[model samples]
Target chain A: MKKLLLATCFLMAGSGTLFAQKYMTRTGKISFNATAVHSPEKIDAINNEVANILDAKTGDIVFQVLVKSFKFERELMQEHFNENYMESDKYPKAEFKGNVANVGEVNFSKDGTYNVKVSGKLTIHGVSNDVTVPGTITVKGNALSAKAKFSVVLKDYKIEVASMVADKLAKEATITLESDLTQK
Target chain B: MRKSLLLSVLSLGFVTVSFAQTDSLMNMLNSGAPVKNEPVAATFKATRIIDGSSVENLGAGVLDFRISHRFGDLSQGSQNFFGLDNATTRIGLDYGITKWLMVGLGHSTFNKEDDGFLKIKLLKQKKTGMPITLSYAGSVSVQTTPAPTLPTGDTWLFSNRLYYTNQVLIARKFNDWLSLQLMPTIVHYNLVDSSKFSNNTVAIGIGGRIKVSKRIAITGEYYYRATNADMTYNGQKTYNALSLGIDIETGGHVFQLMFTNSQGLTDRTFIGQTTDSWGKGALHFGFNISRVFTVVKPREFRDTKATSW
Candidate 1:
């Protein structure tokens, strides 16, 4: 009976460790800036309700953002972005699924910061593209945080801007992401 | 030894189940779960579909300046240059107070009418569940035309020249290319020509848009007068209003070219006072031009003084 109890405790400890590798966050922040070089037009939006999950065991990461949740500095610009550019009604969410290229270099059990390369397929406006971006992952005891800055060309995602206002918008928009996650 | 073996088997089963749970977690992460109850948008591109009000509303703090022109009936022939020579115009400004609330004022050359209206959206269709959108609109109009002849002792009362309309608009977007709407409307005119004509009328309007291209749509609207006798002018029977148009959406403007059997633009006149018949070739060519301007800066840009981007 004592041997059975010891075996059961051992299995419980192993299962707990397996579940601790998954980290999740619901309140991640994502922002984008598109400032035209020649014109005075500046378009910027922020979306704070981003959900992301990371599996440290397999080095898999996933991100989801509701396109309509993005708020712009100008209400009219927001409307145009959703109705004309993003078509949020038809494609409501933008998602990414990728993996950490160098998962062996970082130790999730230790308190440290590691710069990593993440490669994934990002789907935006019903179009998917393979993307690789450099990001930093920070571990502080039980908490994990990640941040990245990247730029994407609008034409690559089939987002067409009319020539009338093409000068007012940048061809490439700079995007920044930050997330503070807790182990689940 | 047998008891220890059974315990070992149980521990192995628990470990296997826990490992399987991780696979399930990965599967859940891979499948993108759809977000629920997001409100559907852009069911109709413009707030007004042809001659009738659409289910759409302007964004908050936005102003819409609109000009509507209706030429004389095509049956007028070349003498009137196919209705090109005679034109009745209406100029209006609509303002959005909220996402679902709007107010507007308009002046029309027909009957020299001055009109104002308030529209409020009560419900919106959501992607997760809600199937239709509902809105309530109310309008008040006053005829400003001077009476041609008046008896010495008789006086014209301002209240008698006033007209009111109450309507409920229900709309549904069936798909990306098609949308339909129904409006149950009631119009009241305080004074009429005689007891022969009713003071109040009920109408049901059906309208739809079929997208033929990315930037153009074929639109039509018909209003059926369910109650009241038709008003006659020179022994001709007036018909219910019917309009067919094409909507072209430019970057910042929506231009609608229509052929309608009604000469008036206000709800009181268009809904209850149409005097032209389509079968008799009384269709009038008209166009509506809409332009929107942002009157108030957004909350983020309101306090910022940095102009150089």
Candidate 2:
């Protein structure tokens, strides 16, 4: 009788976790524009291999991206961004760990869009900073989609721009992200 | 009593599992991730290590304008301004036809020669599995100078001025700081100065680049001729080519300063006809300036977003 009760306790704990809703996407898209206002050439890149996961019960969210996976309009620029700026060999990944502040206001069962405030620690080039951004979460049937736009100062991440290209590369980078996730 | 103790321990394990769930989201996302076969980039900063071709190639749609200048032999003493009195210059234009293929044309003042070459990349090293990068370079040089005066009844044909060279460049980047290359080269001469020397000269070149800083590197190369090592031209014995150089990289430009015993820029003259020996301090100070420009933009810069990814 004691062993049977212990087994029931274990199943209850496991089922509690199994019932928590989680959404994930491996093909999330993240793009950044660092073009200076006076620069003629566009200094922008996009990375489509972003991995993101959201836990609905806890409002916990995470995003991970390989720094070298960002593609630029010029291959040489991509090489410089990897070798010089990001030093991808030393710091290969950029990540964000955060939570949705207003997740309680959203109705996951209903087909509607809700505005959210996401606050997290964003890491890039081996440096981390706390950031908060406004985002939108849309729920339709069994699908969940997220979209956000924000800006990050390059100096905060210790990404140095050489004086030769100082006029071309912007001091702040505007980042945009979009993901279509499925419940798991 | 033992069953009660086991149950307590099992319950403690379940308590820890609840805490692990909050932190395992990143781990869950990474689980079953596909291993990527990413090709290594920037094995060497420039396409040329020292005097020979390196496994590095320019990206497609890029053009490089290269200027190579060699002063006179330093052994000429103060009378020749430490060998700066005479200079041999070669101007070259190299273009990347594709990511794997590059073509070049050059004109050297020393031999009044015009040369054209094609470089093709065969295999590239990957972050894993692959060990080496390989490329093939072939060139043909035509001497445009007037024919030399010959003995009576000696004939000089236009074919005699043509020389062909082929090389297989094999290289490996062992780490971030070190890269080494081996070049097996063959140069065919239509005419030779003497019968003792063969028309086809085989040589092996070994080169290395050591990065000292982000923008500077030390480079060196040595070529040993397997044929006609004992051959003499104009009473001067031939010697192997040895060069040491430094590469300084700025945006859009790579300036290379070197000291070498070979005077010619092409393979035929440098490999087969090098008469100056490093032992005699017969080195020529030289520098090669390379400037690159992007001629075509990648897909990301285009008006349409048609990429599959």
Candidate 3:
């Protein structure tokens, strides 16, 4: 009976650690800007319903966003972004699956901000590309917050800019992401 | 026995820990199903599905300048240059007052008719659960044509020149490629030509849009008047209005080219007073041009320079 009790306690502790290894948030914020230098209209959009998950043990990070969720300054832009650029109906989601390169340097239990390097496969508009981004992760109690900004060539994702709006839209888009997550 | 039990427990814990490490990061989020009750969007590309009001409404603060042109009967052939010689045009401005409400004003050259309408969205369709979007549209058209000279010396009141049309539009977007709508409509004329015919006409309109590509679609609309089916207007027999069009979207503009049996543009004209019959080859080649301008920036992007996040 003593041995059985010890075994059960050991199993419980192992599962508890596994549970604490992951952090997640459904309401992550991600925004992007693709306006050209002399464009008349500002071409920017934001999505607040991004889903993000970070596994502290494995340093794995994942982000998934619905293409239709991105809201633009002009409703027409929003429609064009979905129907023309992203083809939201055909490919409804943009996803990133990657890992933190410096996971061993930061302590997940400590409350501090740590700069990290992340590499991932980003899939947009039914196309996937490998990307690396530099970011910061702040650990506070059981909560973790992350912020990152990166630029991607629109052509890399098969997003085409029509000739009529080529001067208005930049070839590269700057994306900024911020997420607050709690242990799950 | 105790040692064996300990060994099994240790192995079980090791197995689970290894399993956790191998679980792909993307799969973790996928375990939880996606969001629900999200409102569906872009059910129809433009505000009109040919001749009737579609279930779509302009976003708040957007203004659309619409021009509709219809030529005379195509059966007129070379003498009339395939109906190009005669044309009726309506120029309108539609403004979105709120997310759910919109208003429009226009003047048509057909009868020197001036028209205004109000459309309100009552229920929006959802991506998963909700099946249909419902909207109500009410319009008034007044003909400014000279009042007829009455033999009895009766003065024509201003109300006598007015006509009203009320419609309930129910639409469903089944997929990315197909969408359909049904409009149950009522048109009331303040004055009628004959006492035997009722002043109010009841109609049912059916419309659809089929996407041919990302920027092009095929649209069709038909209105069947149940009341006064045999009524005549301007010495012509009335017939059901039928229109078939192709919509081409180029950024901020939507160009619609169509062949319709009705020359009147407003709801009262097209739904209640369409007298040209398709069987007689009285099809009019028409087109509608819609251009939108963003009058107000979205609240989210109003402070574009500020880092609100």
Which candidate number has the best lDDT? 3
- lDDT of residue A111 for candidate 3: 97
lDDT of 1 by residue, A1-184 (tens): 7877787888778778867888888789998887677756567788887788887877888888889989865555677788778988888888888888897787988999999999988889999999999999999998889999999999999998777677778888899999999998
lDDT of 1 by residue, B115-174 (tens): 999999999998767899999999999989886577899888889779999999999989
Please, what are the lDDT tens digits per residue for candidate 3 over residues B1-309? 868877786878667664653235567777784755667788888999998899999999899999999999999999999999999999999999999999999999989999999999999999777799999999999999998888796888999889999999999999888999999999998887778778899999999999998889999999988887776776677889999999998867899999999999999889878888799998999999999887776777776664311
Give the per-residue lDDT of model 2 (tens digit) for B1-309. Answer: 777686777767666655544358888877845567777888887888876788888788888899999899999999999899988888999999899999999999978999999899999999888899999999999999998899999988999899999999999999888999999999898877788778888999999999897778999999888876676655688898999999987656789999999888887778877888899999999999988776765655567453312
Model 1 residue runs over 4 Å out of place are: A1-5, A34-43, A73-84, A87-90, A103-114, A138-142, A162-165, B1-35, B233-237, B295-309
What's the best-to-worst order under lDDT? 3, 2, 1
List ranges where model 2 is wrong by over 4 Å. Answer: A1-20, B1-22, B77-81, B148-155, B232-236, B304-309
Report lDDT (Cα) of residue B220, candidate 1: 92
Considering only chain B, report the TM-score of each candidate against the true chain B.
Answer: 0.87, 0.88, 0.91
Tell me the number of clashing residue pairs for each predicted model.
0, 0, 0
Model 3: per-residue Cα lDDT over A87-131, one tens digit each = 987899999988899999879889999999999889999999999
lDDT of each: 0.84, 0.86, 0.89
lDDT, model 2, position A117: 98
Candidate 3 residue B159 Cα shift, in angstroms, is 1.3
Residue B6 shift from truth in candidate 1, angstroms: 8.8
